[model samples]
Target: MKKLLTLSLSFVLASTLFIGTANFAHAAKAPAQPAVSAVAKTVKQSKSYSMILSALAQNDVIGQFDPTEITANEVGALINKVTQENPQVLYYKSANVWSNGKIEFAYSLPADVMKKNRVALDAKVKKVVASINKPGLSELDKVKAVHDYLVLNTEYDYANLQKNTIPADSYTAHGALLGGVAVCDGYTKAAQLLLNKLGIENHYVIGQIGDGLHSWNQVKLNDNYYFMDVTWNDPVPNRPGIIAYDYFLVTSNQLRKDHSWIEKNWAVATDKRYSYLQTGKTAAK
Candidate 1:
């Protein structure tokens, strides 16, 4: 799911890609904006990042900025940065940037659904973390705890994907954690949130699998980086008590055979000490 095009009149630019969800839906050009007394600052400026994050958490549109701070082509990069860096920010699906200095992000779920479900989602996250994290657990063990939990507990949303009626929650942590059904983005976001809460260093990754866009994660364990794809590890039929570790903790050479991503965008994953295939083990206790 990717789109990059420029409009003649409004100079509208929308970049929408949430992997298997929405399938690169287009964002219409917004109406003209009212004048502001002062130009808005870039998100990199002190305090501006937090303000924008807060607005995004509430599914609000952020306008009144200097369009020069972010051009149309750069909007997609910004959206990815925000979601990847801040795992808790799970609802944004795409971004719309106009030459008139207005920008808005489209969310996977509606504003009302987000408001109604966010609290419950937060609670579920805390509960799951509490249940799995224990004293004296190693970092590797913590990572495995998250990976195993997602693979064993959540069912892939194959029905919706086939029917093209995927609910917005299916693209979010809420669906993976609460609804127990999710696609690639949902599984990745849920893993990102869980790993962050467990004090693990990880980042969500975007890339291509065959012709379709996909989402996964990269983790730093024992000072070595590795990629983990919880979605793929969970089989499509979703057999009970079965978890596949084929995609767990693999290095760049191993993953590149099947996965393709922009090298410059992510950290190079070359270490294999923690790879499940090589060690036949994921963690110690």
Candidate 2:
């Protein structure tokens, strides 16, 4: 993975290969398994989640990859994996229509709109990165920079959730980068994308947070790994101009107080060097 980290956590309820009319919410309401667990077998076709994401990244609905031994449940897990990995690719609606193990991945946006939005999305990410990014900033500073930009620029789309009109784009990095409105998935993916631009290593950590499945990031700092949930740090109900560090840069032990995930799959995050609270970077709550 070239030391490039890509991870995002979302509620496990969204594991199915959701197909629906036009709204992200509609597709999300379908049946799903817990995050990181086996993907529900929605399609009998063979495909790798990683390969499907690569094709989608190029805006090609049709894509090919070696038919791996990975099972359908694994492919299903890619629903969240692909979403987190390619935070910027928003046109992915579903994966159906396979011939000879070649997938015709269905996209939410039309060909023209996909191209147009992709261009716009690319431009927006560059502009945003250029504006907040500065020379000679440390890794911690870079993390904070990205965190601040997202919290300041974007607002949680409570209205969309209430109206049930949430666009599919809102479920992606573009949602936070362009629309300035997203739920936890958009927020977490946007953070990872910006971190990748700064050459940071991280992973999407999926698990149960309280009563629902929520997504967050496992970020690296000073050659040590730590957990950060930007979505949790950013308060909702349109606080307008406040960013909380309560959930910023925490240890696995600290994180386990509320959030939960499979521990065996990831490195044991025992380092507290960058923990905002433990390091006295921020006042303890």
lDDT of 1 by residue, 84-138 (tens): 5565665665556555645666666678878778888889999999988999888
Enumerate residue pairs that collide in model 1.
none
The segments of candidate 1 whose C-alpha lies over 4 angstroms from its true place after superposition are: 1-48, 62-73, 93-102, 105-108, 276-285
All candidates: CA RMSD in angstroms?
Answer: 8.7, 8.8
* Number of the top lDDT candidate: 1
Total backbone collisions for each predicted model? 0, 7
Q: How do the residues 1-285 of candidate 2 rate in per-residue lDDT, one tens digit apiece?
A: 112112122232242221112112211222153454222233433346657667878778676544454433345455545655556666565554333445556666688888877888889878877876788888889888888788777786667766666666766688788889877777887888888877888776666654455667888888787888777665555666766676678888987887777776556678876654533222212
For all predicted structures, in order, the TM-scores are 0.76, 0.76
What pairs collide in candidate 2? Answer: 7-203, 7-204, 8-204, 9-215, 10-215, 11-213, 39-73
